[model samples]
Target: MVTSVLAGFAASAVLIVAIGAQNAFVLRQGLRREHVLAVVAICAVSDLVLILAGIGGLGAVVSARPGAVTAIRWIGAAFLVSYAIMAARRAARPSTLNPAERTPTTLGATLITCLALTYLNPHVYLDTVLLLGSIAQQHPHRWLFGIGAAAASLVWFAALGAGAHKLGPLLARPAAWRVLDGVIALVMLGVAVNLATG
Candidate 1:
């Protein structure tokens, strides 16, 4: 059971380590020092819900549905490609100004954006609830597996937000953002390719 839990944690880490909407938002909040705790809290809780939903037979049902996973694969692939292009463009012609400086900002707006970015993306559900959940189900201690997955999310989100916050000054530079954006583009492109052939 412990091994299963650890394996699930490792699997979750593998998938979540990649750059994506959630990671971007978390890093943004961290750099801004604007409700960074809220952002991580939301992300961790969301992951818990998603991981549980997937492990509790929801994944099997979804996967059993004809073309569901296929549809998600295509949508996720397209989003990843589109996001990669956007990131690369931003990196190439980097913006000196931060977006929060110009955009109308509010807690509600930020929270909604985070939720939309995390949940609205079918890829999230497919990856966490379906793919990872399916793997957990194969383990003897499925509940422990879910717990491990949830633990990974909690730990990762907290660590990421806190670490980025610590590097706030360094990350404030325009050049740093450009580099970050480049990394984001590469991560998205790599994930897209992996999904396409997986």
Candidate 2:
């Protein structure tokens, strides 16, 4: 059981500690010092829900529905493209990148974006549902695996959101924000393309 849990933790951490839209958004929110707790909570809770669903055998149901997957893929791709455009626009106007100078988004709007980032990414489903679920089933203590995965998400989001402000000093310049948004734009578009193609 311990081994299963550890394996699940390792697998989840590996998959999550990658450069992605969700991570980028969370980091930005953290650095900006805007609703960091809310963002972290949403992400961790969302992951918990998905991990539970996967371990509870919803993964099989999801995998069996090719139509559902296709629909989600299309929706995800569309969302990614829109976000990429927004990021590109942000990059174009480096002046708005300053966290202190920019108007803070409403809580509702921030929550919506957080939810969208958590749900609209096909890769999230692929990793949490298909991959994690399949692997957990291989273990005798599947629920334990889910617990470990959920714990990983909590730790990761907490650290990312709470610790992001430490880098605020470095990203104080418009140039830094410009580069960050530019990279985000490129990554989002690339992910969008992959989703559409797959």
Candidate 3:
């Protein structure tokens, strides 16, 4: 059981530690000190839902429905492109970081964007659902593996959101925001292209 849990944790961390849209958003929220808890909750919860669904055998259902996945791919690619454009704009025009200007997005907007980022990414389904679910099924304690994966998601998002604040001093400058946004834009765009082609 312990070995299963450890394997799950390692697999989950490997999949999630990459710099993706969700991670980038969480880090930005942590840096801006804007609705960090809400952002973390949405991401962690979304992940938990997917992980549980995968373990519960939804991965098989998803695999059976290739059309659904294809539809999601196209739609997700479009969404990623739009986000890339937005990030590029932000990078081009570094926003002033006055207290009032810090949270340019309302809580509702931020939450929606967070959800979209989490759900619309095909990699999330492939990794958390198909990959993890398939791997969990190999273990005697599949449920324990799922639990461990979920715990890893919670810990990762919490650390990312909370630890980002520690870099607040560095992010105090507009130049830093521009650089960060530029990187985010490139990542989003590259992923979008990958989705569109694949």
Best by lDDT: 2
Clashes of each: 0, 0, 0
| Cα-based lDDT at residue 33, candidate 1 | 67
Question: What does candidate 2's lDDT look like per residue over 52-164, in tens digits?
Answer: 89989888898899898899889989988999999899888848447546999989999998898889887889999888989999999999998999899999999999999
Per-residue lDDT tens digits of candidate 1, residues 1-198?
A: 899889889999998987776797688677666777878899999989989999888877876784876766666667677777977897888577763353545788778766756765666887899988889879999889989988999999999888886775676677777787788788777767766776
Give candidates' CA RMSD values in order.
3.5, 1.3, 1.5
Which should have the higher lDDT, number 1 or number 2? 2
Q: Sort by TM-score, best first: what order?
A: 2, 3, 1
Q: Candidate 1 — what's its lDDT?
A: 0.79
- What TM-score fits each model? 0.74, 0.96, 0.95
Instruction: Please list the C-alpha lDDT of all candidates, in the order they appear.
Output: 0.79, 0.89, 0.88
Query: What stretches of model 1 exceed 4 Å from their correct place?
Result: 66-104, 178-198
As a TM-score, model 3 comes out at: 0.95
Q: List the residue pairs that clash in candidate 2.
A: none
**lDDT (C-alpha) at residue 50 in model 3:** 92
